[model samples]
Target: MKNLYEKRIDQTKQILAPLGEIHTRPQFGGYGVLADNVMFGLFLQDELYLRATAQIEEVFHHHQMTRLRYIRRGLPLTLSYFQLTDAGWQDPTLFLQLATLALNGARQERAEKQNRERLKGLPNIGGYLESLLLDAGISNQEQLKAQGAKACYLKLDTDDIPLSIKVLYALEGAITGYHEAALPAEKRDELRSWYETRHPTATTKYRR
Candidate 1:
Protein backbone atom coordinates (compact mmCIF):
# COMPACT_ATOMS: atom_id res chain seq x y z
CA MET A 1 0.00 0.00 0.00
CA LYS A 2 1.34 3.44 -0.92
CA ASN A 3 1.53 5.92 1.94
CA LEU A 4 0.08 9.41 1.54
CA TYR A 5 3.56 10.86 0.92
CA GLU A 6 4.36 8.22 -1.67
CA LYS A 7 0.99 8.63 -3.38
CA ARG A 8 1.41 12.42 -3.41
CA ILE A 9 4.91 12.02 -4.87
CA ASP A 10 3.43 9.88 -7.67
CA GLN A 11 0.79 12.49 -8.38
CA THR A 12 3.34 15.31 -8.32
CA LYS A 13 5.58 13.36 -10.66
CA GLN A 14 2.67 12.81 -13.06
CA ILE A 15 1.78 16.53 -13.05
CA LEU A 16 5.41 17.53 -13.53
CA ALA A 17 6.22 14.84 -16.10
CA PRO A 18 5.52 17.25 -18.97
CA LEU A 19 8.57 19.22 -17.85
CA GLY A 20 10.69 16.07 -18.32
CA GLU A 21 12.10 13.27 -16.19
CA ILE A 22 10.38 14.01 -12.88
CA HIS A 23 11.78 12.21 -9.85
CA THR A 24 11.91 12.45 -6.06
CA ARG A 25 14.74 12.10 -3.60
CA PRO A 26 14.87 12.30 0.19
CA GLN A 27 15.70 15.82 1.31
CA PHE A 28 14.96 18.37 4.05
CA GLY A 29 12.88 15.98 6.16
CA GLY A 30 10.71 15.20 3.13
CA TYR A 31 11.12 14.56 -0.59
CA GLY A 32 12.61 16.93 -3.17
CA VAL A 33 10.78 16.91 -6.51
CA LEU A 34 13.25 17.36 -9.32
CA ALA A 35 12.73 17.89 -13.03
CA ASP A 36 15.50 16.63 -15.31
CA ASN A 37 17.90 16.33 -12.34
CA VAL A 38 17.31 19.94 -11.33
CA MET A 39 15.54 20.50 -8.00
CA PHE A 40 12.53 22.78 -8.51
CA GLY A 41 9.93 21.58 -6.03
CA LEU A 42 9.74 20.06 -2.56
CA PHE A 43 7.22 17.87 -0.75
CA LEU A 44 6.73 18.16 2.99
CA GLN A 45 3.88 16.65 5.02
CA ASP A 46 2.01 15.79 1.80
CA GLU A 47 2.14 19.39 0.63
CA LEU A 48 3.99 20.67 -2.44
CA TYR A 49 6.23 23.73 -2.55
CA LEU A 50 7.99 25.28 -5.51
CA ARG A 51 11.41 26.85 -5.28
CA ALA A 52 11.05 30.63 -5.19
CA THR A 53 13.91 32.44 -6.84
CA ALA A 54 14.06 36.23 -6.61
CA GLN A 55 12.71 36.89 -10.12
CA ILE A 56 9.76 34.53 -9.72
CA GLU A 57 9.04 35.47 -6.12
CA GLU A 58 6.60 38.14 -7.27
CA VAL A 59 4.73 35.57 -9.31
CA PHE A 60 4.48 33.28 -6.31
CA HIS A 61 3.26 36.23 -4.29
CA HIS A 62 0.62 36.98 -6.91
CA HIS A 63 -0.64 33.45 -6.37
CA GLN A 64 -0.75 33.99 -2.58
CA MET A 65 1.74 31.21 -1.93
CA THR A 66 3.06 30.62 1.56
CA ARG A 67 6.76 30.23 2.21
CA LEU A 68 7.89 27.07 3.96
CA ARG A 69 8.90 27.55 7.58
CA TYR A 70 9.64 25.38 10.55
CA ILE A 71 10.73 25.88 14.14
CA ARG A 72 13.98 24.40 15.26
CA ARG A 73 15.62 24.96 18.65
CA GLY A 74 12.92 27.50 19.36
CA LEU A 75 13.81 29.55 16.30
CA PRO A 76 11.75 29.81 13.14
CA LEU A 77 13.57 29.02 9.93
CA THR A 78 11.87 30.13 6.73
CA LEU A 79 12.94 28.49 3.50
CA SER A 80 12.87 29.92 -0.04
CA TYR A 81 10.29 27.41 -1.28
CA PHE A 82 6.69 28.60 -1.60
CA GLN A 83 3.70 26.34 -1.10
CA LEU A 84 1.99 25.24 -4.35
CA THR A 85 -1.43 26.76 -3.77
CA ASP A 86 -4.78 24.99 -4.36
CA ALA A 87 -5.27 26.84 -7.62
CA GLY A 88 -1.99 25.46 -8.95
CA TRP A 89 -3.01 21.89 -8.08
CA GLN A 90 -6.48 22.35 -9.61
CA ASP A 91 -5.16 23.69 -12.92
CA PRO A 92 -2.61 21.48 -14.73
CA THR A 93 -1.58 24.16 -17.23
CA LEU A 94 -0.90 26.74 -14.52
CA PHE A 95 0.94 24.16 -12.45
CA LEU A 96 3.21 23.30 -15.37
CA GLN A 97 3.89 26.96 -16.10
CA LEU A 98 4.85 27.63 -12.47
CA ALA A 99 6.97 24.49 -12.47
CA THR A 100 8.77 25.66 -15.60
CA LEU A 101 9.65 28.91 -13.82
CA ALA A 102 10.94 26.94 -10.84
CA LEU A 103 13.08 24.82 -13.18
CA ASN A 104 14.60 27.93 -14.76
CA GLY A 105 15.35 29.36 -11.31
CA ALA A 106 16.99 26.14 -10.22
CA ARG A 107 19.17 26.10 -13.33
CA GLN A 108 20.23 29.70 -12.80
CA GLU A 109 21.13 28.94 -9.19
CA ARG A 110 23.17 25.92 -10.26
CA ALA A 111 25.00 27.91 -12.92
CA GLU A 112 25.85 30.68 -10.46
CA LYS A 113 27.02 28.14 -7.91
CA GLN A 114 29.28 26.45 -10.48
CA ASN A 115 30.75 29.83 -11.40
CA ARG A 116 32.07 30.37 -7.83
CA GLU A 117 35.60 29.02 -8.28
CA ARG A 118 37.26 27.71 -5.12
CA LEU A 119 40.94 28.06 -4.28
CA LYS A 120 41.08 24.59 -2.71
CA GLY A 121 39.96 23.16 -6.06
CA LEU A 122 43.24 24.37 -7.60
CA PRO A 123 46.34 22.22 -7.99
CA ASN A 124 48.75 21.75 -5.04
CA ILE A 125 46.24 23.33 -2.64
CA GLY A 126 45.22 21.19 0.32
CA GLY A 127 43.18 22.03 3.38
CA TYR A 128 46.17 23.12 5.49
CA LEU A 129 47.64 25.40 2.82
CA GLU A 130 44.18 26.76 2.05
CA SER A 131 43.73 27.55 5.73
CA LEU A 132 47.11 29.30 5.87
CA LEU A 133 46.14 31.34 2.84
CA LEU A 134 42.78 32.13 4.39
CA ASP A 135 44.42 33.26 7.62
CA ALA A 136 46.71 35.48 5.54
CA GLY A 137 43.60 37.11 3.96
CA ILE A 138 43.46 35.16 0.70
CA SER A 139 40.15 33.30 0.32
CA ASN A 140 38.90 32.52 -3.19
CA GLN A 141 40.67 31.85 -6.49
CA GLU A 142 40.15 35.46 -7.47
CA GLN A 143 41.83 36.67 -4.27
CA LEU A 144 44.63 34.14 -4.70
CA LYS A 145 45.23 35.32 -8.26
CA ALA A 146 45.20 38.95 -7.11
CA GLN A 147 47.82 38.20 -4.39
CA GLY A 148 50.05 36.11 -6.66
CA ALA A 149 52.30 33.26 -5.47
CA LYS A 150 55.21 35.40 -4.38
CA ALA A 151 53.10 37.89 -2.43
CA CYS A 152 51.13 35.04 -0.79
CA TYR A 153 54.39 33.31 0.20
CA LEU A 154 55.69 36.56 1.64
CA LYS A 155 52.53 36.93 3.70
CA LEU A 156 52.97 33.42 5.15
CA ASP A 157 56.65 34.13 5.78
CA THR A 158 55.70 37.27 7.74
CA ASP A 159 53.27 35.19 9.81
CA ASP A 160 56.31 33.15 10.98
CA ILE A 161 54.79 29.99 9.50
CA PRO A 162 57.53 27.44 8.76
CA LEU A 163 57.48 27.25 4.97
CA SER A 164 60.07 26.00 2.47
CA ILE A 165 60.92 26.24 -1.22
CA LYS A 166 58.41 23.46 -1.82
CA VAL A 167 55.63 25.67 -0.39
CA LEU A 168 56.54 28.40 -2.86
CA TYR A 169 56.55 25.86 -5.70
CA ALA A 170 53.20 24.59 -4.53
CA LEU A 171 51.69 28.07 -4.44
CA GLU A 172 53.05 28.81 -7.89
CA GLY A 173 51.69 25.50 -9.16
CA ALA A 174 48.32 26.29 -7.64
CA ILE A 175 48.25 29.72 -9.28
CA THR A 176 49.40 28.37 -12.67
CA GLY A 177 47.30 25.15 -12.43
CA TYR A 178 50.24 22.76 -12.63
CA HIS A 179 51.47 19.97 -10.40
CA GLU A 180 53.99 21.26 -7.89
CA ALA A 181 56.64 18.72 -8.93
CA ALA A 182 56.04 19.58 -12.58
CA LEU A 183 57.13 23.21 -12.20
CA PRO A 184 59.70 24.31 -14.80
CA ALA A 185 63.36 23.89 -13.80
CA GLU A 186 63.93 27.61 -14.31
CA LYS A 187 60.97 28.50 -12.11
CA ARG A 188 62.05 26.00 -9.44
CA ASP A 189 65.59 27.37 -9.48
CA GLU A 190 64.26 30.93 -9.33
CA LEU A 191 62.03 30.16 -6.32
CA ARG A 192 64.84 28.27 -4.56
CA SER A 193 67.17 31.26 -4.98
CA TRP A 194 64.49 33.62 -3.67
CA TYR A 195 63.82 31.35 -0.64
CA GLU A 196 67.52 30.94 0.24
CA THR A 197 67.94 34.72 0.13
CA ARG A 198 64.90 35.22 2.39
CA HIS A 199 65.81 32.46 4.88
CA PRO A 200 69.40 31.21 4.94
CA THR A 201 68.66 28.40 7.49
CA ALA A 202 65.08 27.39 6.71
CA THR A 203 65.05 23.88 5.26
CA THR A 204 61.73 22.37 6.46
CA LYS A 205 59.21 21.65 3.69
CA TYR A 206 55.79 23.35 3.72
CA ARG A 207 54.00 22.33 6.96
CA ARG A 208 52.63 19.40 4.95
Candidate 2:
Protein backbone atom coordinates (compact mmCIF):
# COMPACT_ATOMS: atom_id res chain seq x y z
CA MET A 1 0.00 0.00 0.00
CA LYS A 2 1.32 3.42 -0.91
CA ASN A 3 1.65 5.74 2.03
CA LEU A 4 -0.60 8.80 2.27
CA TYR A 5 2.32 11.06 1.37
CA GLU A 6 3.20 8.80 -1.53
CA LYS A 7 -0.34 8.95 -2.86
CA ARG A 8 -0.37 12.73 -2.50
CA ILE A 9 2.92 12.80 -4.40
CA ASP A 10 1.33 10.80 -7.21
CA GLN A 11 -1.72 13.03 -7.23
CA THR A 12 0.46 16.15 -7.30
CA LYS A 13 2.25 14.74 -10.34
CA GLN A 14 -1.10 14.18 -12.05
CA ILE A 15 -2.18 17.76 -11.31
CA LEU A 16 1.12 19.17 -12.53
CA ALA A 17 1.33 17.11 -15.76
CA PRO A 18 -0.55 19.69 -17.84
CA LEU A 19 2.27 22.12 -17.15
CA GLY A 20 4.95 19.69 -18.32
CA GLU A 21 6.65 16.43 -17.49
CA ILE A 22 6.72 16.37 -13.68
CA HIS A 23 9.60 14.41 -12.28
CA THR A 24 10.09 13.54 -8.62
CA ARG A 25 13.13 12.95 -6.46
CA PRO A 26 13.53 12.18 -2.78
CA GLN A 27 13.93 15.38 -0.81
CA PHE A 28 14.52 16.03 2.87
CA GLY A 29 11.52 14.02 4.09
CA GLY A 30 9.29 13.79 1.05
CA TYR A 31 9.69 14.68 -2.61
CA GLY A 32 10.60 17.65 -4.80
CA VAL A 33 8.83 18.21 -8.10
CA LEU A 34 10.82 19.35 -11.13
CA ALA A 35 10.38 20.04 -14.81
CA ASP A 36 13.47 20.26 -16.95
CA ASN A 37 15.41 20.10 -13.68
CA VAL A 38 13.76 23.27 -12.33
CA MET A 39 12.01 22.83 -9.01
CA PHE A 40 8.41 24.09 -8.86
CA GLY A 41 6.68 22.02 -6.23
CA LEU A 42 7.37 20.20 -2.99
CA PHE A 43 5.49 17.42 -1.22
CA LEU A 44 5.65 16.80 2.48
CA GLN A 45 3.40 14.54 4.47
CA ASP A 46 -0.23 15.18 3.31
CA GLU A 47 0.47 18.67 1.93
CA LEU A 48 1.85 20.09 -1.26
CA TYR A 49 3.89 23.31 -1.45
CA LEU A 50 4.48 25.56 -4.43
CA ARG A 51 6.82 28.49 -5.00
CA ALA A 52 5.39 31.86 -4.04
CA THR A 53 6.41 35.33 -5.15
CA ALA A 54 5.17 38.78 -4.15
CA GLN A 55 2.61 38.68 -6.96
CA ILE A 56 1.65 34.99 -6.94
CA GLU A 57 1.72 34.96 -3.15
CA GLU A 58 -1.67 36.64 -3.24
CA VAL A 59 -3.01 33.53 -4.91
CA PHE A 60 -1.90 31.47 -1.94
CA HIS A 61 -3.55 34.00 0.33
CA HIS A 62 -6.70 33.93 -1.78
CA HIS A 63 -6.80 30.16 -1.46
CA GLN A 64 -6.01 30.42 2.28
CA MET A 65 -2.83 28.45 1.84
CA THR A 66 -0.19 28.66 4.54
CA ARG A 67 3.52 29.13 4.03
CA LEU A 68 5.57 25.97 4.48
CA ARG A 69 7.71 25.79 7.60
CA TYR A 70 10.40 23.43 8.80
CA ILE A 71 13.02 23.32 11.53
CA ARG A 72 16.70 23.78 10.89
CA ARG A 73 19.34 23.83 13.62
CA GLY A 74 16.42 23.97 16.06
CA LEU A 75 15.18 27.19 14.51
CA PRO A 76 11.81 27.45 12.77
CA LEU A 77 12.33 28.73 9.26
CA THR A 78 9.59 29.60 6.80
CA LEU A 79 10.48 29.57 3.14
CA SER A 80 8.79 31.01 0.06
CA TYR A 81 7.13 27.64 -0.45
CA PHE A 82 3.43 27.82 0.33
CA GLN A 83 0.91 25.06 0.89
CA LEU A 84 -1.85 24.38 -1.63
CA THR A 85 -5.25 24.49 0.03
CA ASP A 86 -8.09 22.15 -0.83
CA ALA A 87 -9.02 24.48 -3.71
CA GLY A 88 -5.74 23.55 -5.43
CA TRP A 89 -6.37 19.81 -5.18
CA GLN A 90 -10.04 19.82 -6.21
CA ASP A 91 -9.59 21.72 -9.47
CA PRO A 92 -7.04 20.58 -12.04
CA THR A 93 -7.38 23.78 -14.08
CA LEU A 94 -6.75 25.90 -11.04
CA PHE A 95 -3.87 23.63 -10.12
CA LEU A 96 -2.17 24.27 -13.44
CA GLN A 97 -2.69 28.01 -13.17
CA LEU A 98 -1.29 28.19 -9.68
CA ALA A 99 1.52 25.81 -10.64
CA THR A 100 2.64 27.99 -13.53
CA LEU A 101 2.70 31.07 -11.34
CA ALA A 102 4.69 29.21 -8.74
CA LEU A 103 7.13 27.89 -11.34
CA ASN A 104 7.74 31.34 -12.78
CA GLY A 105 8.36 32.76 -9.35
CA ALA A 106 10.68 29.88 -8.55
CA ARG A 107 12.63 30.38 -11.76
CA GLN A 108 13.14 34.08 -11.12
CA GLU A 109 14.03 33.54 -7.49
CA ARG A 110 16.51 30.82 -8.35
CA ALA A 111 18.10 32.93 -11.05
CA GLU A 112 18.54 35.99 -8.82
CA LYS A 113 19.85 33.90 -5.99
CA GLN A 114 22.32 32.16 -8.29
CA ASN A 115 23.46 35.48 -9.73
CA ARG A 116 23.89 37.02 -6.28
CA GLU A 117 25.99 34.08 -5.17
CA ARG A 118 28.05 34.22 -8.33
CA LEU A 119 28.57 37.96 -8.00
CA LYS A 120 29.78 37.63 -4.43
CA GLY A 121 32.51 35.27 -5.60
CA LEU A 122 33.64 37.46 -8.48
CA PRO A 123 36.75 39.62 -8.36
CA ASN A 124 36.08 43.39 -7.95
CA ILE A 125 32.36 42.83 -7.36
CA GLY A 126 32.53 42.99 -3.58
CA GLY A 127 30.07 44.75 -1.30
CA TYR A 128 30.85 48.31 -2.35
CA LEU A 129 30.84 47.83 -6.14
CA GLU A 130 27.68 45.78 -5.86
CA SER A 131 26.08 48.69 -4.02
CA LEU A 132 27.10 51.05 -6.83
CA LEU A 133 25.58 48.72 -9.42
CA LEU A 134 22.38 48.43 -7.42
CA ASP A 135 22.21 52.21 -7.00
CA ALA A 136 22.52 52.52 -10.78
CA GLY A 137 19.58 50.05 -11.17
CA ILE A 138 21.69 47.10 -12.24
CA SER A 139 20.45 44.47 -9.82
CA ASN A 140 22.24 41.27 -10.76
CA GLN A 141 25.02 39.79 -12.85
CA GLU A 142 22.51 39.04 -15.63
CA GLN A 143 21.37 42.65 -15.71
CA LEU A 144 24.98 43.83 -15.57
CA LYS A 145 25.59 41.57 -18.57
CA ALA A 146 22.64 42.99 -20.55
CA GLN A 147 24.11 46.48 -20.08
CA GLY A 148 27.65 45.25 -20.84
CA ALA A 149 30.68 46.07 -18.68
CA LYS A 150 31.73 49.35 -20.32
CA ALA A 151 28.24 50.82 -20.29
CA CYS A 152 27.82 49.96 -16.62
CA TYR A 153 31.23 51.37 -15.76
CA LEU A 154 30.49 54.57 -17.61
CA LYS A 155 27.14 54.81 -15.83
CA LEU A 156 28.91 55.14 -12.50
CA ASP A 157 29.29 58.83 -11.57
CA THR A 158 32.75 58.50 -10.09
CA ASP A 159 33.51 62.22 -9.77
CA ASP A 160 34.74 61.77 -6.16
CA ILE A 161 35.50 58.06 -6.33
CA PRO A 162 38.30 57.27 -8.74
CA LEU A 163 37.30 54.85 -11.51
CA SER A 164 40.10 52.83 -13.02
CA ILE A 165 40.72 50.09 -15.55
CA LYS A 166 40.77 47.43 -12.78
CA VAL A 167 37.04 47.96 -12.14
CA LEU A 168 36.49 47.07 -15.77
CA TYR A 169 38.36 43.82 -15.29
CA ALA A 170 36.21 42.98 -12.29
CA LEU A 171 33.01 43.58 -14.23
CA GLU A 172 34.26 41.31 -17.00
CA GLY A 173 35.03 38.60 -14.45
CA ALA A 174 31.55 39.01 -12.97
CA ILE A 175 29.96 38.58 -16.40
CA THR A 176 32.05 35.59 -17.48
CA GLY A 177 31.94 33.93 -14.02
CA TYR A 178 35.71 33.68 -13.99
CA HIS A 179 38.60 35.52 -12.40
CA GLU A 180 39.83 38.66 -14.16
CA ALA A 181 43.25 37.03 -14.49
CA ALA A 182 41.67 34.26 -16.57
CA LEU A 183 40.26 36.77 -19.11
CA PRO A 184 41.72 36.46 -22.62
CA ALA A 185 44.32 38.95 -23.83
CA GLU A 186 41.99 40.36 -26.50
CA LYS A 187 39.24 41.06 -23.98
CA ARG A 188 41.68 42.77 -21.61
CA ASP A 189 43.00 44.89 -24.47
CA GLU A 190 39.50 45.87 -25.47
CA LEU A 191 38.69 46.94 -21.90
CA ARG A 192 41.88 49.01 -21.78
CA SER A 193 40.91 50.76 -25.00
CA TRP A 194 37.45 51.69 -23.70
CA TYR A 195 38.83 52.78 -20.33
CA GLU A 196 41.51 55.05 -21.79
CA THR A 197 38.97 56.70 -24.05
CA ARG A 198 36.61 57.31 -21.12
CA HIS A 199 39.12 58.44 -18.46
CA PRO A 200 40.12 62.10 -18.84
CA THR A 201 43.69 61.52 -17.58
CA ALA A 202 44.30 58.09 -19.11
CA THR A 203 47.18 58.84 -21.54
CA THR A 204 47.17 55.46 -23.30
CA LYS A 205 45.19 54.84 -26.49
CA TYR A 206 44.37 51.83 -28.62
CA ARG A 207 47.27 51.70 -31.12
CA ARG A 208 44.98 50.16 -33.71
Best by TM-score: 1
Q: What is every candidate's alpha-carbon RMSD to the true fold?
A: 13.7, 15.5
TM-scores of all models? 0.55, 0.53
What is residue 101's positional error in candidate 1, in angstroms? 0.6
Q: Clash totals for all models, in order?
A: 0, 0
**Per-residue lDDT of 45 in model 1:** 91
By summed lDDT, which 10 consecutive residues of candidate 1 come out lowest?
70-79
CA lDDT, every prediction?
0.78, 0.71
- Tens digits of per-residue lDDT for model 1 on 83-195? 99889888988898898999898788666745677668999998888866753446578877877787777655532445667788999999888899999999889988877
lDDT of 2 by residue, 1-208 (tens): 9987777778877877877788887644567688777777777777888877778888788888898876532335455678888877889888888889988876776577654744455566887878566534465666778877876765553343346677788888788876777788999999888666555565333211
After the best TM-score superposition of candidate 2, give how far the Cα of residue 177 lies from its true spot, in angstroms. Answer: 18
Off by over 4 Å in 1: 1-3, 117-208
